[model samples]
Target chain A: MIKARITVTLKNGVLDPQGKAIEHALSGMGFDGVGQVRQGKVFDVELSESDKAKAEADLKAMCDRLLANTVIENYSVAIT
Target chain B: MKSAVVLLPGLNRDRDMIAALTKISGTPPLTVWQTDTEIPDVDLITIPGGFSFGDYLRCGAIAARMPVMRAVAEKAAKGVMVIGVCNGFQILVEAGLLPGALMRNTSLKFVCRQVKLQIANANTMFTRRYQPGQIIRSPVAHHDGNYFADAETLRRLEGEGQVVFRYAEGTNPNGSINDIAGIINGQGNVLGLMPHPENLIEAAHGGSDGRALFESALGIAA
Candidate 1:
């Protein structure tokens, strides 16, 4: 079994309102020197296939097809 | 004029859309369910608002992949008119039937109110009833109505006049880029917008600022 992790994040130049709100809230709570806060989604998927390369490719297709909105977001696949 | 409404589970605005199409077109629109793979011939196909699948994963993400959307895509490819409002807009974008993505509101809060909408391109069949540069009122209610696209795509949309509606003046409720409220597909038949034009089609619902849109799409004489 191969387990894969997918992280979907808003691409640079795309506005992140939720992330900005979180950043503001952290500052309101007195967290100092907080830089830009960006929000993203993570998915842990398991595949019965034992091939790491094939699993990674499948995960990427999953992101391209459903897991991420490629217009405004980018995703990374990590197999462990 | 014949029209149809796309129906999916957890959507609350199908009734409103049906009523609007019926009243405007003088014939009830066929309702295409999520599981249905076939949609009968119709002039306009509308996808209404409200949460679908509780908006899991992302707004319209799950619903966009349903069987009905495939049929919708097929119809759209054949040059049928398709309009998606609010969450409907999200679904169209998610389904890749339309350009750009509807992100969370800039305020991070659900916005439900009226905003002024300018007819960015009145030349399309959907907006022919409205005069060029005409401004009308539209009601928007959604948590994720902010639209985003790559700079290249944005440039093309603007250059091709695919942007059909823009928030007029300073009523940019969700911080959408270029204050875009509605857009049409590159082929010009499919439209996706955040505002609820169906909700304001009659006098009882207040001024009929949105009636012209339905009239145009339904081929009714204004």
Candidate 2:
């Protein structure tokens, strides 16, 4: 079995509304000096039976097929 | 009257959406799995709410890239009505079928409750049943329902009247700007909203305001 980790995030230049709201609220709470905040997602997958190379390929396929939106999101995978 | 609902692996409210469609359209809708490469022909395509792929790597992130979404996007471009609720809304946004993204609540807490929504734009196919400035109640359950957009994008949405539903006054549950509960694309074919209209199809569910959405779609086909 191979274990793989994936990360997904919104593409840069797209406004992150949630992040901005938090920034405002934090500033209101007197927490100034905060620079920037971008949010992303993490996924862990355990392949039933595959070598590292195959597992990485499968993970990338999953990202490309359904896990990440290539238009506005990017994904990366690490296998162990 | 053929309609279909896309079903992601972790979808939990598909049955509810199906039930709503059956009751409204007098037929059970077809279900298209995420792995399916083809989308069945239908007048409307609904992406039901659920933790698709366990909401991994972000809500709706995984499902947005699924094979079915590609088909959904293609169909949408041809002018099929696409409605996405909750996590489905996230998927639509992630798929770039709609502008903007749903982010975590500013409070960082999962919100689950009935929220009041104002019908901001009643001219769209998904909202023609509603009267302008009317208030309706729908249930919202999610951790990331905060809608985000750039200033220019927001202005454009407003100018084009693409903003469909806004959170009612004094009930901005998710802190969405202008209390936006739902929005439609410029073409007005695709609609995405955080609140679950599927959950409020019957009076027993505490309200039937959501029925209007289904009715509007049916009316369009009729």
Candidate 3:
């Protein structure tokens, strides 16, 4: 089995309100020098396919079709 | 005019949409389920507001991939009138039936309240019953109602007059870009908005400001 991780994140220009809230909370708790914080989502999947390239492509398709909203976010896949 | 309401798991507002359509059109709309690969003939198709698929991953993300949405998209492509309210709007965006995306509210909160709406464009099939630039009241209840579109898409939407509604005055509940509350597709047949026009369709719901939308879509004048 091949295990992969998909990371989905808001694009740079897209506003990250939840991340901003977290940043604010960190500052309130005295965490200094925290310039910015952006939020993202991660998904882990295990594929029975023995071919690493095929598994990677399938994971990318999954991200494109379901794991991410490409209108405002970007995604990347890593196989472990 | 005949109508139908799309249903999916975790959606709670299908009945309200049905009730509104039934009372307004004098006929009940058929309730279509998620697994149905085909939708019967209908003039207007409405996707009601609610947390479909438990809002997993993102509001409407999972539900947008269901067979029913594909059917909705097919019908929409054929120039049928489609209206998606709140979570329905999210689904439409997720399904790529509409442009842009809805994000977490700028306030990072679930806001449930009444908001004043301005009919941004009354020339479309859904707003012809109202005078241009009319101000109306509608209720909103959602956590991720903030609307966002990239610069080019925003320009196109405005240039094409696809923007149908805006939060009137200071009632921008979720900090949507340009105070946009609702928009129609380029073809002007699919409308996806975050307000609950169904909830305020009559006096018993506090006002009838939202009835003209149904009237216009149904081709029935008030």
Candidate 4:
């Protein structure tokens, strides 16, 4: 059995109001030297396939199909 | 006119949509559940507003994968009319049936109120009853109605006249680019909008501005 991790985040130019709010809250709580905080989602998926190459491709397809909205978000998959 | 409304789990506005379509089309629209894989023969398919799947994993992410949506997308490709309102609009965007994404309102507040909309294009079947540039009032209630799109897509929409509705008179309730209130697919058969036209179709609701939308959609108006 193999496991994969996928991280989805808003693209560089996309506006992230929620992340901005979190950044403001952290600064209010006196966390200095923190320049920016962009929020993202992470998913840990278990694969039944043992072939690392096929599993990596499948995870990418999963991200492209549903795990991320390519218009505003980007995702990266890593097999562990 | 034959029509159907797709019902997803947590869809709170199905009844309102049914009532509106029934009153306008003179026929109660067929209600198709999300589990259904096929949609009955109908001229129009409406995906109504409400918090589908409790708005989890992005507003319409979960509901967009329902079997009924597959049928809806297929029918839309064949030129059947599809109207997606509020959360429905979000679903269409997430399902890749429409361009852009509905982000959280810039203010990060749930805005619920009537807003003036300008008819951007009245040549299509969905907006035929309204004069171009006419101002109409409709209620918008959503926290994630802010529309976001890349500059190229926005330009393409504007150039193609796919932008069907614009929030009027600089009354930009959300941070939607170009103050877009609604848009149509390239084929002009699918429409996704943030406002609740179903709620404003009766005089008892204080305005019939939304009635023309139904009338145009049902092909009963000049």
Q: Tell me the tens digit of each residue's lDDT in model 4 across B1-222.
A: 899999998888889999999998889999999999999999999999999999988899989998889999999999999999999999999999999999989888899999999999998889999999999999999999999999999999999999999999767788898999999999999999999999998889998899899899999863
Of the two candidates 1 and 3, the one with more favorable DockQ, higher being better, is: 3
Identify the candidate with maximal DockQ.
Answer: 3
At residue A8, candidate 3 shows an lDDT of: 96
**How big is the positional error of residue B164 in model 3, measured in Å on the Cα after superposition?**
0.1
Question: Candidate 2's residue-wise lDDT over B1-222, tens digit each?
Answer: 689999988989899999999998998999888888888889999998889989876688878878899999999999999999998899999888999878767567788999899999888888888899999999999888878787788999999999999999887777676678899998899999999988888878887889999989877332
Error of 1 at B151 (Å): 1.3
Complex DockQ, candidate 3: 0.92
lDDT of all predictions: 0.93, 0.86, 0.95, 0.93
Give fnat of each prediction, in order.
0.82, 0.35, 0.88, 0.59
CA error at residue B174 for candidate 1, angstroms: 0.5
Candidate 2: stretches off by over 4 Å:
A1-80, B220-222
- The two-chain DockQ for each candidate, comma-separated, is 0.86, 0.25, 0.92, 0.75
Clashing pairs in 1: none
Interface RMSD of 4: 0.8
lDDT of 4 at B140: 92
Model 3: per-residue Cα lDDT over B136-202, one tens digit each? 9999999999999999999999999999999998999999999999999988999999999999998
List pairs with backbone clashes in candidate 4. none
Q: Candidate 1: misplaced stretches above 4 Å?
A: none
Highest lDDT: give the candidate number: 3
Off by over 4 Å in 4: none
DockQ rank order: 3, 1, 4, 2
> What lDDT does candidate 2 reach at residue B136?
92
